[model samples]
Target: MATFATSDQLLVIIDPAARQTDGESVRIVKDVLSAGAAAKVCLPEGPEEFARALGRRGSRRPVVVGDDRALVRAVTLLHRHRELAGCALSVVPVGSTLALAQSLGVPTSAVAAARTVLDGVERRLDLLVDDSDGVVLGALDIPPAPVRAAAVAEPVSAASGRPWLRTTYRSLVRTLAPRPPRLAAVPAPGPCRLRVEVDGATVVDLDQPVEAVSVTPGSSGAAEVEVRPLSVGAEATPLRASGRTVTVVGGDFRYRADALVSGPVRRRTWTVSEAAWALTLPAHP
Candidate 1:
């Protein structure tokens, strides 16, 4: 339902750090946008360098050429600048593990993804902000220990995984990686009570001792909160919720705040806040 004028300009911002990791692909990105030549492109130093670039972005539909982290950074910048509410955000994902791009329906190959940028559609999706001031969308996973190799020598470790997975890489990395994200709140076998209030309901009482608790707040306050006992192979996908605040109770625990990895403390309690931030996504492809 959102539209940008063909006459309007476009600005491209590529994360410099992303460039180092995928230099060739970054060149491809520049070439594709340069193929347009006339569209304005803004290159920032990194996630931290985006603010000044933020001040200069005009009314043109913004195009991002990088991985999920870069995408998140740009969107967060626009949201903070109050530009997301009105603009159509686009991404030409350049990373091998660009899962969120697939979720957004952008092509994976730099060239094809660029074509999507050339002819794209717009969608208004939800943005997630954690209690520790982290902003994200697509996923916030709390994984168990990485699945170790069975003593057999393999050509690749999860850390060294090829960027060749295309659309299936994210799920693959999530499944095969030996080391996964940790939970700040959940300790080992020792059980601790956690309080959970979803949509303001005391759904999880203090009587339950859980291996860990996960809460995700969705758009409009629809929330899903869950707690599971810890077992050697036990796992839980990040739960979804849409409450303003989720207060946990019981023994002290810490939690990861998005990609920063687990770092929250509950002096027997934790509060999770959910809200959407402005994000510019690809418009046509």
Candidate 2:
């Protein structure tokens, strides 16, 4: 466990979504931080304000008060400015789902997380940066078609019994859909054709259709890649690889990176940067 100076200053940014949904948790977080050190709080109403708050943080360590998405946004903003390496972050997760935060070793309860923020040690962590300069702090997945097939069928079934109407409704739904998350992976409606490569070695050629794929930052300064092929019998063997870089090429595919969903791109490549960022966690006893 690594320690920090008790006198260290902190800047706590509260995500608007958290404020809207759980004001009590936000208040508790602020009180805990205030009791510990010289802390400044910023409640950003939207994305732009959130970015600006971090940009102006000066020398204070940033402590995010929200869920996984909020933490990702902060990391991405810091990474863009190339200031991520020099700063350590703390998180007090307050939202519906905290899978990403929990995976990172952050405490789940409001009080426990706040205490961690105030007294935790700083630890280095790896990150995945894609070709588009996007960042993923945890696992990235390309799920099988069956995972989302029923979802597509739901809206169609709800439209009516007419085939043409169903087709028209589906088209309309596609057209009206909002743009995917800018830096996160949003799952596609169905499976896609993809060719995966790790460290320049081809793992899955486009000729053979794949069921799914996943890429995660490995502890040994490498990216862990897994390719799940379409199974014919009981189960099919998965191909796995570990390397500094992983690339995928296909028609258009979607992927889930940690808690956020992104994509519908022709191709994307991600490289692991060892110990690229730092986070706060409780000191080991």
Give the best candidate by TM-score. Answer: 2
Per-residue lDDT tens digits for candidate 2, residues 1-285, read 334464478899999989876788889889988887788899899999999999998888898999889999999999999999998999999987688889888898989999887778999999999998899898898852323211222432665878888888878877999855445443544445788999899999988777789888888689889898877787889999999999999986778887777777888999998999999998862
- lDDT, model 2: 0.84
TM-score of each: 0.64, 0.81
Which residues of candidate 1, in runs, are more than 4 Å off?
1-8, 130-133, 141-193, 212-221, 224-226, 229-252, 256-258, 267-285
Give the poorly placed runs of model 2, Cα more than 4 Å off. Answer: 1-7, 144-191
* lDDT per residue as tens, model 1, 95-129: 54477767756678888877666665555555555
**Candidate No. with top lDDT:** 2
